[model samples]
Structure formats: structure tokens, C-alpha cells
Target: MNYTDEEICTQYGDRPKDNRGAVSPPIYQTSLFTFDTFEAFTHAQLYERENYVYTRGVNPTTELLEEKLALLERGEKCKCFGSGMGAISSVFFSLLKSGDHVLFVNNIYGPTQQLLEHLQNFNIEHSFSNGDVESDIKPHTKLIYVESPGTMLMKVVDLRKISTIAKKHGIYTAIDNTWATPIFQKPITLGFDLSIHSLTKYIGGHSDVVGGAVVGTHELIDRIFTYGFQLNGSVLSPQDASLIIRGLRTLPLRMKQHQDNCLRVIQYLTTKEEVLKINHPSQWKGGAFSFIDDQMTGYSGLLSIELKEGGFKKVAAFINQLSIFKIGVSWGGYESLVNSPIKENNELELIEQGIGTGIIRFSIGLEGSDLVIADLEKGFQALHSIKS
Candidate 1:
């Protein structure tokens, strides 16, 4: 049954009356579950998902979190991992043979590119696309991976169109839906094969946990679970799983506030002369908004802005002057963050991805819009002084 994201967020992972009728699910923090007999052990081994045998293979706490995530993504199953990279690597290792090729759509996560580079030792090939799925596909192309409202640039891809092309080519489609979250966009509903999330972000919500998940068909997820997840030992701790559960309960509310604050910040940014360009789905032209409006329920608190004129020194000055927004990596927490694609004395990867030198990526937190805007104004003043 199709449930609203708000309803699913609150209702999907309710524990039964077996645990003294507790409202919150208890953490099953154990290495293994003991079986009463050999027959029972054999049954658990045969049907791993139905019964927990080992914490490495399955844990009740993690399983409950997985079930809730699967429902949120509108998928048949989901498997959580120790980190976002773990989830992504498991998918690639499970599905791709030595000679298989993957076509990555625009502006994918930086670590994903590194992962593909490492996969070259195993004879896997990958290429970046200009968003033309049909033209980019080669005979050996087995998968099409995309990140919509992509990292740094906030570029949006047409998922339905990409999924349709993948279907025609008999290839699987996967997406890093971390930006939109399941509350905003469900790629599976639009025909994508898999939807992955870095649960450390919005799903975990509090910036307290580090984890990832892949949501897809029972068969596909099971293959990843067996071949990649277990073998790699990228298991989510029961404590972390419990924290994510608490985060899920308030996800809908958090996302709403995020969207509202993002809109306000974007509006404020438009009036700043130092702001050369804004990269956001809401600001796109040429029918981009039509797809965004139709596919996504809301936008998250992430956007990129290019300074009017600056090099690395000016960029550093601007970042240093910000008081409320902390200078750090990995956003989607309760605190605002500011990061530059071009770090001091560092080689430019963002430039290769078409991001500019003075571009700053903002992950607006649950702060008041007025206060956040004021902080940015001071940052701009610092940039002005540096430019002088």
C-alpha cells in the first residue's frame, strides 16, 4: 500500500507487544542469537532474513531499521551498512562482473569516482555521462548510476527518462538520493532499480550516526547482502540503528523546516551582489522546474553559490568570517556548514566536474533564516575586504 511519507515515517517500524509493550524498539546488541536445537539453527541459516543467526549477517535492531528504510524508499528490501561508501561499493561489487561497464551521470559524489578508479584493478570500466543516457550507453554497459541535484552543483537529472533508457538497454539504474531524501523523492516509484542513502545525513538527522543503505528488489538486495555486505563486514551497529530509528520518527518535520529555510536562504542569496550564480533546482530554467515540481515533494537544505569574483584567498577569507555556519565536511546535521570545492593549495576536482573556484556549498541547518542570512552578509563583507 502507498502511504504518505509523514504517515510512513511515524508508523512503519512499530514494535510488537512482545517486548513488554514498549513504544521504542529495543536494541538487540548481541553477536549471535542462540538456537534451541540443530533443526532450528538449520532453518535460521536457510532463511536468514526470517530469523537472525549472527549479528554480522543480521540483527533484530538493524533489521527493523532496514525494514523501515525499505518502506520509505518504496522498495522490496534494504540493507544498512557502516558507511555510505560501503553501501555504494557493495552494489557495484555484487552486480558488476570484471568486464562490466558503468555509466555515471553528472556530478556524482567524489568518493564514488575514487571507488570506480579502484575497481579498475578488477577489470571494471566506468565513464562519466553528459546526462544523455542513450548516447552514453555502450554494449558492455551494465549499470547507469546517477545523483540528482548532484553534489556541489545541485544539478538535477531526469530520473524517469534515465530509467526508461536503462529499461530499453536491459541495464540497472541506481541513484544516491541523499539530497532529496525519501520524504521528497522515491526513485523506485519512478522506475529506478535501486535507491541508496547515506543515513548519516538526513535519515540519521542528528549527525550522531554514520551509516548507509540500499533499497531495491528482494533479489537484488539479497545478492548484495550475501555477496558484498557480509563479505566486506560493513555492518551497522545496533546502537546506531536505534539512533536512526529515533531520527526517522521526526524526519518529516525536519525536512519541512529544511525546505522552508532553504527557500528563504535562496531568496536572500539572490539579492547579494557577491553571489554570481546559484545552483539549485528551484532556480533552473527550461522546463527543469516542471520535472522537479512533479517528481519531488520538497527541496532539502543544500545549495551551491559562486562568488562574483574571487580566487582561493578570497574564498578562504569568506569562509573564515562565518560565525554560525561551521567550516566542515559532511552536512545534513542540525548545524549549518560551509565548504569550498577548491580548498587552499589543493588540486581542483570540482573544476573537472564544472564547479568553479570560488563556489561554496551550503548545507543550511535548522537555524532561523534571519540569523543565517545575517551570518552570510558578514561573510560577503569579509570577501569584499579581501577583494580590496
Candidate 2:
């Protein structure tokens, strides 16, 4: 039988076997596991993905987390890692050979792009999908990587169309599904081959832990484990896995408040003279093709805004005046965060990405909308002071 995301999050992994019938799963914090006999030990080592002989291959705590994640993404298997890049790198190394090409769609994570650029040294090639994704495909293109409702511009492309295109050319498809999480968009159901996520964001919920995961069929995930995962030597600690497990129980509730607070902030920004354009999936007014409602159940609190004025000095002054919203490099926590791509000397690059020189990204937190709005008022006042 099928279960709701909340049910799966809260009670899917109900173990009644041990630990005084503890309601919360305990961390099996040891680095190694033992068996009754040499025969059993040798047998378990052969199927390390399932049986735990060493923590490097599997731990009871981290394995439990992986089970829930695989079910959440509607995939047959999953592998947890130390960070989001770990999962991405695993997919790349496991699937692509030295001569293969990669096609990236929408605005990918900056570090992901950097990793691909570094792969150029090893003879791997990558191209960003500018206008037509299908047109950018080369004979050697083996993967189509994407980030929908992209973190920066918030532009979303049609996933089904992209998946169909990739399948036609026999290319594997993967999406950085961190922004939507499994609560909003499930890529496998939409016909993609793999779905990857950064658990450090919404999954960890409190910004306390860093983790990553990839969900797909057993065949594909096994390939990643054999070639990319074990060799890369990235492991999600049992303690961190336990923390993420705690975060999972309240994901639905936190997501609702996040979207609610973000909507209020968007509403307030619409009335401000200092605001030029607001970029969000839920707030799309049809200028660009953002068909989110049909694909995703909801949007995260993250969104970007273009200021009426331009340049880094102006935007920096506004960010500095904010009392509640901290200027942080990461998001997906209880406290709100603000960041921007408008650097002091990257105007040409910003223009090329279709970004204004005064764009700012906000990750609205669980704090009441009133407080967030009040903090934003302070930022606006700073801009006004600069004008005077």
C-alpha cells in the first residue's frame, strides 16, 4: 500500500526488535561489526551493501536513513554521503568514462559547475543548456544534469520533456533535487534516472549536519556504490545520519511554514519601490516558462529579487543593515538567510546569466513572517539612507 510523505517520514522505519523498544532509532556508532563465525564474516563482506562488516560500507544507523530516503524518492535503492557533491561526484565517476560528455540544464550549483570544469583535465566535457537542451547534446553526451526552479534565477524547465529527450538519445538523467526535496518533486516518477539531494539543507532542517544522497534503481545505485561511492571515501557519520533522521519527522510542518513565510516576504517585496522583479516558482507571472504547479506540490522558501538600483555597494549596504536575516553562504535552517551573486566586479558575468547587478537571494526561515518583514524594512531604510 502507498503511504503519505508524512507517514513515511514519521513512521516508515518502525523497528520493534531491540534497544528497549525505543521510539527513536539509536546510532550504531561503532566503526565495525562482528559475526559469530568466519564463514558468516566472509559471506557478509561479499554483500557489503546489505550486510554490515565495516562502517565504511554500511552502518545500521546510516542504512536506516538510506531506506527512508529511497522510499521517499520512490527509488529502489539509495546511498548517503558526506555532502551533496559526494553524491554528484559518485554519479559522474560511476557512470561517465574519461571521454564522455555532460549536459547541464538550468542554473546548476556553482561548485558542481566547478567540478565539471576540473574534469576537463581528465578529458570529460560539459556544456550548459542555453536555449535548447536537445540542441546542445553531442554524440558523446552521457548525462543530462539539472536543477529545477534553479536556486539562483528560479527558472524551471519541463522535466518530462527533458527526460524524454535524454532517453531518446540514450543518455542518463539526474537532477539536483535539493531545493524541492522529495516532499515537492520526485524526479524518478517524472521519468528521470536518478534524483540527488543535499541533506544539509531542508533535510537536516537546523543547519547542524551535512549529508547527501542519490536515489535510483538497484542496478544504477549498485554501480555508484561499486565505482564512485567506496572509492571516493566519503561517509555520512552515524551521528549525522541520526540527526537527519530527527529532522525528517518534522519536515512537512517546517516546509509549510517556510513556504508561508516566504509568500509573505514576496508580497511585501511587490509593494516596495526598491524592488524591480521577484523570482520564484510559485510567484511566476508567465514571462518565462515556469510550470511548477503541474510538477511540484510546493516551493521552498528560497527565492531571488532584482533591486531597482544596481551595483554591489548598494546591495551590500542593505544586507549589512538587516538585523534578523543573517548574511550566510548556506540556507535551509530555522533562521532566515540572505545571499547574492552580484559581486563587486562581475557585471559581465551577471549579465550573461540574465541576472541584475543588484540581485539578492533570500531563504525565508520558520521565524514568523512579521519578524522577517520587519528585518526587511530595515534593509529598505538602509537603501533610502544611501539615496539621501
Candidate 3:
């Protein structure tokens, strides 16, 4: 049955027998489950998803999380993993062969680029495109991967256009939908083959847990489950799965607040003289918004800002002076976080991706808009104090 996002959260994982009539799902923490007889054991082995024989293969708690995530993303099934990269690597390893090629949209996650480079050792080939999906296709291309409101720069791509192109060549399409989440964007409904998420981020809704999920057809997910997930051994813990389930219950409310806070932050950012550019979908003009604008219901807390003038020293000063916003790596939690795209040795890579050294990415949190704005004001004050 088709359920709204809010309803899906409250009711999707509710099983009276599984939870012993408790409203919340209980964590199946045991490593292994016992069967009454040899025939029962054989049935368990044969129908792995239907019956849980081992925690690594499947656990009741983790399976509940998977079911909810699959429904949220409008996919047939979902497989949870220990981390975001775990789910992503499983997809690549399961679907692509030694001779296959992959075409990636520009400004993907750094680790993803590194993963593609590592795949070269096994004779896999990959190419990057700056939104030119049609022109980038190669004869050996088996997959097309994209991240809308892409990593660092927040560049929005036309997913439908990419999906159409992939379909012409009989290729699969996968997207990292962590930024938008299922509440705002439904990639599978828009013709994507798979939708992936870093459940540690917005889906987890807290800083405590780390996990990932891949949502797609039963056939594809089963293949990944049997071949890649089992072999990689990146199983999510039952405890963490339960936490994610708790997070799911509040996801819709949290996301709405995130959107509201972010829009307010962007409004304040526009008034700053030092703010040169804001990379967000809401700011996309003309034809750029024609496709994506309609599909996405709202934006998340993640956004990028390019300063008018700054180098590493000024950048360091700005980040150091901020009190409310923590200088951290990952975002999409309860607290606001800030980061610079440029690192000690990765300046060239940032430049190659069209991300400037002065650009700062902000992950707006649940903090009030006034407080977040004041914190940024102090950051900019520190930036201005430093000599260019």
C-alpha cells in the first residue's frame, strides 16, 4: 500500500509479534538465531530474508530499518550497511565487472572518486562529466552515478535527463540521495534504478549512529546482498539499526525545520559583503530549475558559500573564531557544523572541481535562525580582520 512519508514512518515497521506488542521495535541483538529442527534450519537458510539465521546476513532490528527505508525511498527493497561507503562499494562491486565502465557526474564525494581509482586495479574504467550525460557515454559504460546538489559545491543535476540517457544505452542509474532524503526527493519514482543514502546523516538525525542503505529492486538488492554485502562483511549493528529507526520517526519534522533554518541562513548570507556566491538549488536560474525544481519539494541544511577574498590564513581564522558552529567533517545532525573544501594537500583537487579555497560549506542545524546568523557574523568578522 502507498503511504505518505509521515504515515510510513509511524506504521511501516510495526509488527506486533516481532515487538511483543510493544509500540517500538526491539533490537534483536543476538549474533545467531536457533531453529527447532533440521528442516526448519534448511528453510531458514533457503529463505534468508523471511527468516533470520545470522545477524550478519540479516537481523530482525536491521531488517525493520531496511523495510522502512525501502518504503521511504519507494523502492522494492533495501540493504543496510555499516557506513555510507560500504553501501556504495557494495553496489559497484556487485554490479560492475572487470571490463565494465562507469560514468560519474562531476563533483562526486571524494571517497567515491578514490573508489573509482581503486577499481582501475581490477580493470574497471570510469569517466567524469560536467552535466553532459549524452556526450560522456562510452560503449563499455554499465552505470551512471550522480549526486544532485553534488558534494561540496551543491550543484544540481537533471536526474531525469541522465536516467533517459542511461535507458537508451541499457545502463543502470544510481544516486546518492543523502542530501535531499526521501521526504524531499524520490529518485526511484523519477526513473532511477537505485537510491542510496548515508543513514548516518539526516536519516539518523543524530550524531550518535553511523550507517548506510541501498534501496532498489528486489533482484538488484538480493544480488548485492548475496555477492557484495556478504563478502564485504560491512554489516550494521542491531543497536545502531534501532537508533536509526527511532530517528526515522522524527525525520519528517526534522527535515522541515532544517529547510526553514537553511533558507533563513541563506537570506542572512546574501546580505554579507564577503559572501560572493551561494551554491543552492533555490538560487538556480532559468532553465536550470525547469526540471529539478519541480521534482524536489524542499532543500536540506547543506549549502556552500564562496568568500569574496580569502586565503588559507583567513580561512583558518574564520573557522577558528566560530563558537556555535563546530569545525567538523560530517553534517546533518542536531548541531550546526562548518568545513572548508580546501585541505592541506587537496588544493588542486578542489580547484579541479571548481571549488575555491575560500569557499565554506555550512550544515545548518536545529539552532534558531538568529543564533546561527550571529555565529556566522562573528566568523566573517574574523575573516575581515585578517589581512589578504
lDDT per residue for candidate 1 within 54-146, as digits (tens), equals 988989899989988898898999999999999999999899999999999978898999999999999999998965679989999999999
Q: Looking at model 3, report the run of 10 residues with the lowest lDDT sum.
A: 285-294
lDDT of 3 by residue, 236-335 (tens): 9999999999999999999999999999999999999998899888788667578877669899999998888856787888889888899999999999
How many clashes does the backbone of model 2 have?
A: 0
Candidate 1 segments whose C-alpha is farther than 4 A from its true place: 285-289, 346-350
lDDT (10s digit) by residue, model 2, range 1-388:
7878898889888585666788897889999998999999999988998899888888989998999999889989999999989999999999988999999999889999999999999999999887598999999999999999786888888898899999999999999998888998998998999999999999889999999999999999999988888888789999999999999999988998899899888999999999998998887645455456667888889998898896888899899999789898888888899999888789899898778898999999988999999999998888976752
The global C-alpha lDDT for each of the candidates, from Candidate 1 onward, is 0.89, 0.90, 0.90
The TM-score measured for candidate 1 stands at: 0.97
Model 3 pairs in collision: none
For candidate 3, the TM-score is: 0.97
**Cα distance off (Å), candidate 3, residue 196:** 0.5
